[model samples]
Target: MNPTSHHQGSQRCGLDALGQFDEIVDVRTPAEYADDHIPGALNAPVLSNEERVLIGTMYAQESPFKATRLGAALVARHIAEYLETIFADRPRGWRPLIYCWRGGKRSGSMTAWFNLIGWKARQLDGGYKTWRRHVIDTLAERPAGLDCVVLTGPTGSGKTRLLQSLGAAGAQILDLEGLARHRGSLLGALPDRPQPSQRGFESALLQAIEALDPARPVFVEAESRRIGQLSLPETLLRAMHAGRCVRVRAALPQRIAFLLQDYAHLFEAPDDFGRTLERLIGLHSRQTIRDWQALIAAGRRAELFQALVETHYDPAYRRSSDSHYAGLDQAMTFDYDPTADDGHAQARALIAQLRVPA
Candidate 1:
């Protein structure tokens, strides 16, 4: 028996054994892969999304024999295509780790084909499900060991930009918004980009945290549990809440100016902007909503934005920050001028401060 193929029940070997392979091949449908997969794994699906769905329906409504026949034929065709295109250039000694939704037929078929063709391939035991469980387990304990510094500020205070600047200045930073691909606010969604799946977000977060030094303080933005549709891991959220706090302070005018520049897409797409405001109808009066919509129509965005800051975001931010962030009132305050450059300079200064022992 092959030493690597230590198949006890369904799993080929331990999860840590994944690093031994030349490549990780995800044989699940594209949709499943997109939702979440092993990081750095190549997508060489043995079944398309529609095909998987159709086969599943047939298995339930028709007969297992019929479903198996169709699925086997489709899997064979996909593997043939992969050999012709993706695997055509692969050398004889290439070894791959193959996985699907659950180390089932999809991954098994791919691994069998690769092995039959003179290359050694192993199937991931329990597949993506096992990998996901490992992520969840790691995250549950990962944050407890890291020293964290939480950066706190209201909306449009340039927290995300400053995080980038700090990262450039050699500071360890966890950019939650960047990972989620959303700004963590009502109007925070990017125009063309969609947020990652919940599992994908967790996977990204786990990898980022693992890369950081546990001995040094890692800087991260203060956020509520959720960033758009993605929820922060509970252990990570607790770590941020317990960390030392640094507040980024800016005047209303500066914040508004930064927001205007940052959210320029809203002006370009008035209808979408108006639709976002519709979420606020329950909180604000209908007249107020209409008035804000009118500002978009009249191209008076600055005034409209100012009103949102004063009436909505500021109050909510203050209340949340005061309650959630420990020692927030006594946090080291870093102020900046109105421009983006000034925000970066502030980040550099903060980095300098962090270098000195408290």
Candidate 2:
């Protein structure tokens, strides 16, 4: 086997270096890989879910020597199969970065085989644990010199639309709701897609944040700590809370019109919509929920949306902004017409308003 390559400090093995290899391989079990692995890393588990469990049980109930021998036999069989299939197509110069849970036996065994087969394979010094630490540390500390411009407004005010517009117009934006696969409300879950696991969400968040330039302001929507089931990183929340705010203002009628179109899927499944509204039972009166359900059943969508905005969303928005966001009363107001405007023009004007005076 070629000499094993190792990093001196796992923490110092920044993502930049990890990106150099042709492939990043996670040789842990499928379940472990599913929990979370390095972003873009491919799963090629040396020990499968069942095999890992069997090895563990043997290690505990029997002796380490017997467990090692059994694990070796299984691993050898798996590797031989892989070589004839997955690795068979690989060229001689192919290079891969391999890791298991703790950079232990599973990955080491694979690395040894790959090297013997004339491929350069480097083992991640501390494996997934190191990458996890990097993610936590990166999120815990806000990017240096980063300034945020948070878009604040009541539900259905088109904050998400305007945020998208700003990004297309060249402003850096962190689309938290998009990343979380959530709309950030009780009725926010998408009709077709499920929200990502919390770990998956964080991995995406870190990757998105890392891609932006810290010298420029990142436009983000004002949000509660939690989005659907995932919570924003604490440092990110604090940064947004301390950032300058812009309150998007849209007339109530326009907001109602926008919601009817934006949330058209909810109307398609009235039962699901009504069941979702039931989550607000403790927050609103029983009679109020009954009325909302009555409207859903009757297909009085516009009226239902209007009532929800006035009774539930608007009140909660005011309380959240008033408490969490500093300097909200003095925030710049962006009057929006979601019905007529496609947001590009508004985005340009908003950018002009945000420009610092020379």
Candidate 3:
């Protein structure tokens, strides 16, 4: 049975009406809020993790009446606290959009109270589940008239950095690696920052894609089906594969220099760096792994980076690019040196060239 609504004086709203509210409040537990929520929504959980668990256990082992009674007390206390603090200094005409797991009691309780207090608050009709569905569906369908200009090359080619330059010079881009918080590689994990949950990644992806103009070309780095723990939507992969291909080229010495500068953080954390190298054990011989670790121990950054590129990154990139991207042999070339000052100018030239035609 559908849960009864306590949202009085305000109607339940669909996803279409999301922009109508001044504020979006998520009333799920803190853990749920942390997992993923609306991009700009504020978390105003009605019940905490412990209290929610207690109430659920009571509902299963005891009676619904008892569970409801306990939940009501907890919800009342939380709402009272919010009124005194989080929602304290609100203006008379303020509005808020509230949601929970579904259009259920947790959010309804807050919505009812907000309306009674003279602030118009609306409950999301089907709650976050509705928005999640929209994210998935939108990502699965290719946007009409969308064109992707794919940047392809081996690692350390400054593709990501160049994409940023392109954006600075007024070109559309989708930085999948940036969104995933993973560098799209085994070693790409940021030491201090962790990757987002798959759902969170998709949410950000949809928002970024939606912000682009479909008539203009969208520049994106060539990638495999997956970026870290998140999988690229098949529709996006199709668009990327079918788009114009550009190979970013740089000399070997510059590539090594770029890697050294870009990944300087790894050098500071020796133990973690050593352990990360161990992941390549099966791919490389034990002796090769030992040599790489020794390089780390001796602080031989240049030789170590050079060996890694020649042995691992370059070969793998060749195989993947050949199989995944189209028209590589005939791809347009963009020379980029990370140490050079002409990057933005190069990006602008490429943009003009891309606008000319295939």
Candidate 4:
């Protein structure tokens, strides 16, 4: 079921009606809000951190009635404060759509309060959940008429970093790894951090793409639909498969050094490193993986990287390359030691050339 419009007064704003709203605010808890939120939402929570806990504990351990009274008291206090301080002398017919975690009492109460003040306020029937689903559905599927430039390279080729650098050079680029927060690999997971729910990931991607100029070319890292724990939206995967690929080839030593430097935190946390290595091992044959594990046990990190690239990583690259349409990946080999200024200059020239038809 859709997450919007459960009540009569609530407005059902799907992807289409989202544009009509003047402001969208998320009033969920800070932890919930931080995981990922509406692209431009203001976080004005009704409950303070401790007050929410007090209410939750009441609901969980005591009784729903006790929790209800406590929640109502807090909500009323905050709502009045907001109306007086934030929404004072608001424009006529000031329509506001308010939402909390489940489109329940918190949002419903706000809707009624605003209605009493002559504002056409509505509760989000499904709250943030509906918006999250909308975001995932849109990004997972491809929209029409978007040309893509996919950056193809082995792990630690600095694809994510390069995308940012290219964006700095005024090239429209999509930094998918940054959005997912997974870095798109077994080693990509940061310590104690889980990837966003698939729905959250889609919302972020759609927001990013919409901000770019559709008429201009877009640069993104070439990746499979799945990036670590999360999966790409189906639409985006198809778009990438059909897009032109730019092969960014670097030397083995450079890639190893880059990984060590970029992922220094992984080394600091033994559990993250061990878990990442264990997962990678399951993807390969027992002997090959065991051999790699042996290198790690012996503390030969660089050698382990070189072996994986020559055996696993390089083979995967060749297979992906072979399946492309004719002349799909126009190769651009860079020096193992690319000065920052030179890399930017080369990337800019390539992007401009990509803007022109072959």
Candidate 5:
């Protein structure tokens, strides 16, 4: 775990050893760090967002010499601030992993400063880009090593809730929609929180998969290749397709009730709901869309949701599930109640059933 031992000029460190460092520092600008960074890494930006933009503009339009001088000054000021505030109480043995966008000047400068101060600091080889590439590669290869149990059902059947319950009951679960910060549907967007970049989603997925034991069955909701704007890694998608399937079924009324509770946000923002519904314009007739809109306008959400399930979602689910899952029809069917307690009970029952080998 000695930082100097792994500091062979840009030699990539094993991701499994990330925990060896006392801290992981992201030296990218606030905006870049906000978009995504290594999980648990502390932000220690070498430049502010405005400063980065100013430097880039100067570098491109004015002169590289002037830009270099200005950038150096800014980096010095920021590093001084970190030393005074964030790293003020650090011990002599403090070991930190530093990274920037591409392991270039920003992280290098910080690492040099830390080394001069006598604390061991290593620059992440290839920086954030390297870590991102690792995530993409890991996701592409890792799922094949897992024993996945794919959960398939139409919308509003409480699949996500069931996954949570199962996880709480000691089952290994992969919540892809959660990692993507989406619900894997047209109206799946969470309020205020935007979905992560594709790289961010892959990073989260890689970490989640890495934590699971490959020998045990992983319970995961069956989803289309894409979740929001992110695409599933091909290997994970293939593993889901080939995995053993479990179908959760609920009555139309029960589904509408569950959806009403789950999508309360849609009710709070009627206009946003209307706009999202417009995405289905090509599939449903104008009159049908108008009718659904009227239901939203009239606050008849349950009725509208029922209509959507009967007309749009259920049909789409049937088509996609049958086409993708070879074991769809023969899947172990679990009938779920609309209530929370019943959902947990059903999850427990499913877990017990899964324990018996097929």
Candidate 6:
């Protein structure tokens, strides 16, 4: 682990270190918390979802004074009994770190109350928003020595699964897609989950990378800077794009089957297929969009996919791949048999190829 990642006192504790606190609480509402929070931060929202909605309305329609008046009464009502129970029989020496969305009035009030009772407490500066950006930057500013390799390929090429395979061979791999709770595309959002906040995403990335030896290169998939709702730390994205690419190719049928497996969730709600097509409208013609939407409405996902493949995915893949085609000399492209019989031999061959000096 990087030295700075471990120091909570320096206003720079990596999310991993902070996660180790005795009490890691997220003061945001359950809805806010549900939309991807730091994995372990307990939701002890100062405001309930409805209460937050009510307060937001007050802030928008009435004056800030009115909003504060409404907010205080509720927070005090909701927390008074709870705070008493939390501090009961405990000495003032317990340490806690409290944070709100922006580390504003809500968290400040809690921190002050904790301090008044003689407890050692600190308010997270700038709140969750600040910490999030810190996670992003920490990832970008690669701790000075960690070497890395990016596994580059088109959609549905089994990049994330391959990371696990590399792990079996004792290789370091960072599954960025898994970290972001995203496969890094418009259709990448998992069926019922949201991506992590940018900060949470960065913290996860940092923790994974810190576990590896910096002197040894680690494998990661090629991804755009933004992954679903979260953005990749710019520095790390730069490093990933700049790193040598290892190409993995599967025959057409195998690639399609891999896509189906990876995006199996989408098929369950097949009728909702239009959502992705709607998102891609800006990238295509109105007529093309309508035609695809019609296919989705008719429950012809196979036809819809074929339409998308012809109109969108295939062309885009070729264009994007062409631009960065310069590094082919450094690439180690390999094919895998779709049949199970050749799996081990193929895996061994790829691993052995990776063992060669880049």
The TM-score leader among the candidates is 3
Best by lDDT: 3
**CA shift at 349, candidate 3, in angstroms?**
2.1
C-alpha local distance difference test of each model: 0.85, 0.85, 0.86, 0.70, 0.85, 0.67
lDDT of model number 3: 0.86
What TM-score quantifies how close candidate 5 is to the native fold?
A: 0.92
Task: Give, for candidate 1, the lowest lDDT window spanning 10 residues.
Answer: 1-10
lDDT of 4 by residue, 131-205 (tens): 776775656454445677777777767777677778878888888888888777656775666778766677777
Off by over 4 Å in 4: 1-23, 29-36, 45-71, 77-97, 101-104, 112-126, 140-142, 191-193, 270-275, 282-299, 320-341, 355-358
Give per-model TM-scores.
Answer: 0.93, 0.90, 0.95, 0.74, 0.92, 0.70
lDDT score, candidate 1: 0.85
Name the lDDT value of residue 181 in candidate 1: 97
How many residue pairs of model 1 clash at the backbone? 1
What does the lDDT read for residue 340 in candidate 3? 74
Per-residue lDDT for 230-320 in model 1, tens only?
A: 9998898888888888887888898899889989898898988888898998889888988999999999989989999998899888777
What value does the lDDT take at residue 151 in candidate 6? 68
| Clash pairs, model 1 backbone | 11-125
| Sequence-dependent TM-score of model 4 | 0.74
Against the correct fold, how does model 6 do in TM-score? 0.70
Estimate the Cα RMSD of every predicted model relative to the unseen true structure: 3.1, 3.8, 3.0, 5.1, 2.9, 5.6
> What ranges in model 6 sit over 4 Å off?
1-20, 31-39, 49-73, 81-94, 102-105, 112-120, 143-146, 197-203, 206-212, 274-314, 337-349, 356-358
Instruction: Give one digit per residue, the lDDT tens place, for model 2 in 1-358.
Output: 1222446533223344676689888889999988788889888888889999999999999888999999999888888998998778988899788888877888889888888888887787777877777788888885434588889989998999999988888889999999999999988998888988888889889999989888788899988889999988888888888889998999999999999999999988889888888989999988999999999999999999999999999988877744687857679999997776668888888999999221
